[model samples]
Target: VCSPEYWVRHVREAVRFADGVRALEAQGVSRFVEVGPDGVLTAMARECLTAEEPSAPVLVPVLRKDRPETRVLTTALAELHVHGVPVDWERLFAGRDARRVELPTYAFQRERYWLEALTSFASDVTAVGLIPPTHPLLGAAVELPDADGFLFT
Candidate 1:
């Protein structure tokens, strides 16, 4: 989808999730802790809850501080503790835990030579104003098309 439609869908989904959180609050859930890579979800939850209920749950995001990758999880747990969210890290990381996993990575390979050639052709065509007047790509100096599909009488 285009940029405007993509953004509109994103906003709608966010609002729907927010509404779900509000429904949970209506059912008397007074505390929420969002655990994820970023705090975006927590922020949205906060906004949704505030809009629905003046006095609602305490929102907490586990990872808010900057730290090395190795220490980030531990730091997040500590921060959650300081914010009064109890966590059982030892149990969560008990024995036989897989320390690492492998996955394939791909590199982007495009023919820049062909891309440059196409760009040059397009620029030359635009400079000459040879494109049809009714085409959306035509810029400010577009000549209006006649009823018979010609540019002028």
Candidate 2:
């Protein structure tokens, strides 16, 4: 996914949603639980399942954007429990003396998006196309421009 050559293909993910759902079906995955801070993917996942068939499996999200964090988690856990998935509450709460203590409700942080512009010398030069000068042909057929940064082609 880090490769720039395949970057353009990531645009098709939304279009290939049904194919992904079918692949999951082949793997016998009925329940789709997305463990994230929101339900965006869960909604799209449900849409893909419904497109293939009328029936749908248990789709749950661990947290919701609008709702309270604790309430959303509790509801999601309940949904999973009802779907015959065993939840080890004792094991989950083991060892640590974790207790709910009131703290700050939210912390606001802004994201910065910065992009750098690329500079190309050949772009400003008018060439019959590549008469582009090589290193050996620099002084022979290609004449150097008098300007400071003008590209020779």
Candidate 3:
């Protein structure tokens, strides 16, 4: 496909670039890193993705003409990292005194404790032949031999 005619035809014909992006999206690809001089391709990919989709793909631009090269690349890496992308932190921070810090758990975590309530109230107090006090408005427990159990008044 290196022939002059092939190159000419490739440039002349309308390419299905957006279709290719959508195909990638269909393949469960939710992250795209554009390693170009600018974010033109990233912007185009963003446009190709539909807004109705629940989870949109993350588009990270490696470089920008107006921004510093290192700054742009680092920002892109940070963006990817924040979007659940695995990054080699050690490699990136090589030759530096960077140490990984364990982040503390959230103050008000939303995790479900899912503790099952006690279905049966029969405890050791009841097992020892003594009826346990359960009622909130009950006074001192009084054992009634006729009732065969303690009654609250």
Q: Could you say which candidate leads in lDDT?
A: 3
lDDT of all predictions: 0.58, 0.63, 0.74
TM-score of each: 0.36, 0.47, 0.56
Tens digits of per-residue lDDT for model 1 on 1-153? 569987788777654676788798788776776777655687688777754545445665555434244444565566556656788766766794635454335544552333334555554555655443445665324332211122421
Model 3 TM: 0.56
Question: RMSD of candidate 3 to the true fold?
Answer: 23.5
On TM-score, the stronger of 1 and 2 is 2
List candidate 1 stretches off by more than 4 Å.
Answer: 1-15, 51-56, 63-72, 79-86, 89-153
TM-score of 2: 0.47
In Å, residue 65's CA in model 1 sits off its true spot by: 9.3
Please write out the lDDT profile of model 3 over residues 4-116, one tens digit for every residue: 99779879998787998899888888999898788788878888986476456788888877657886787788888888998998999999998988754775487565656
Residue range 31-148, candidate 2, lDDT tens digits: 8788877878876887777435545477788876756787577677777787778887666667879665665556634633344433653342223222344575453233222211
Worst 10 residues of 1 by lDDT: 144-153
- Candidate 3, pairs of clashing residues: none
Q: Between prediction 1 and prediction 3, which has the larger lDDT? A: 3
- Alpha-carbon error at 92 in model 3, in Å? 1.2
The order by descending TM-score is 3, 2, 1
Model 1 residue 85 distance off true place after TM-score fit, in angstroms: 4.7
